[model samples]
Target: MALYNAAALIPSGLLSVVFSLASIFNALNARVFFGEKIAVRVVLAGLLGVSGLILLLWDSLTVSFDPDTVRGIGWALLGTMIFSWGNIASRRNSATRTAPIIANAWGMGIGAGVLLVLALATRQPLVVPTDPTYLAALLYLAVFASVIGFTTYLMLVSQIGSAQAGYATVVFPVVALVISTFFEGYAWTATAVIGIALTLLGDAVMFGRFGRKRAGKILKLT
Candidate 1:
């Protein structure tokens, strides 16, 4: 939340870079701190993901930072660190006794409880519905984003390995931009178009096409 609020002041490009770098650094920490060996494919995927993010936000990369952006950067870094730790822990938990469904339900329930408690304590409005649009937004977030996306992603992690499954998130901005263009009437700049191309290319690199014999060979090497 803090990081997102900070993002309002910071350039989106810088925020993306900061988050990407944090995740990469956390992956490195997985190797050093947790003693999980880093695969070459994972490293290459990280590079491609960050590069794509850079290309995606190339036009906004020049914005000067303010105090809020600085704070936002700190939050972004910390949030990612926490997130990485959670990922590692969740993976470990899955490897142990618990099923992924139970783990996810517990985690989400606890998180929601914490947020609700905080909101109530601070007198924040839990539901300030001015229109039916708010209900539709809630339904979309609950049904599509939270329920479906998380469920599928966790399943993907178990099947493909977390590092590979993680690459799916790198395409979120591409989806967002496409939606914005169609629904919000966003103008497409040449840079934006190029960014989308790069993002898709990066995804292809991260998730090598099934028919690519060379990529299959590389996976075998890994």
Candidate 2:
């Protein structure tokens, strides 16, 4: 979480790319820890997802040799690694019959406590927003983003393992763009359209929806 906060300070599309790479780490870690075989289709799907992410953020992919930006990128990469470990941990906990809600509760509670201690040690001001708009945004994030999102994701981790569940990060940008078109009046370019298509294709490949017989054959090979 600290790494993620630090990465948010970087001003480049590099973080997006780094975050996409988390899926790779998630997949590799799952293989290492769970003894899961890495199918060729999974590799292809991950590559496609990464390619789509890069294409989606192509316009913002500027090179900055500044020290801070480079440091932030490093922080983002580290955060991605930690995030992947969290995913694997979640999977492990779920396999042990731990309830998702209980796990999330303890995780978030510990994280909040740590942040509070850090804030106090650093003498940081804790300001509560009184603005109605800000309050509403906070409510939405607390309910939908934090509660519902984590629950659903942890459930997915339990059902499908961490590697496939990690694809959610890859798919979120496409969903965000679709929502932005309605809410933020975001205009879609041809490049974005191509990226969206590729992202969907990647998802399809990952899920092995090309054909049941072929998917079975591929699974057997793995």
Against the reference, the lDDT scores of all candidates come to 0.68, 0.79
Instruction: Name the runs in model 1 displaced over 4 angstroms.
Output: 11-14, 21-26, 32-34, 120-130, 209-222
Whose lDDT is greatest here? 2
Cα RMSD, each candidate: 3.9, 2.5
Model 2 weakest 10-residue run by lDDT: 5-14
lDDT of each residue in 1-222, candidate 1, tens digit only:
645665876777676666665435545766866687665555666676777777777777876577766777787777666656656666676678566777778878998899899899999987677788988998998888877767666666666655666565566666777798899997877777776776666566656653244455777876
- Per-residue lDDT of 128 in model 2: 100
Look at candidate 1 and tell me the lDDT of residue 132.
86
Candidate 2 global CA lDDT score: 0.79
Per candidate, the number of residue pairs that clash is 0, 0
lDDT of 2 by residue, 115-200 (tens): 99999999999999799999999999888998888888989989987878888878877777789899999888888778777888
Q: What does candidate 2 score on TM?
A: 0.88
The local distance difference test score of model 1 is 0.68
Estimate TM-scores for all models: 0.77, 0.88
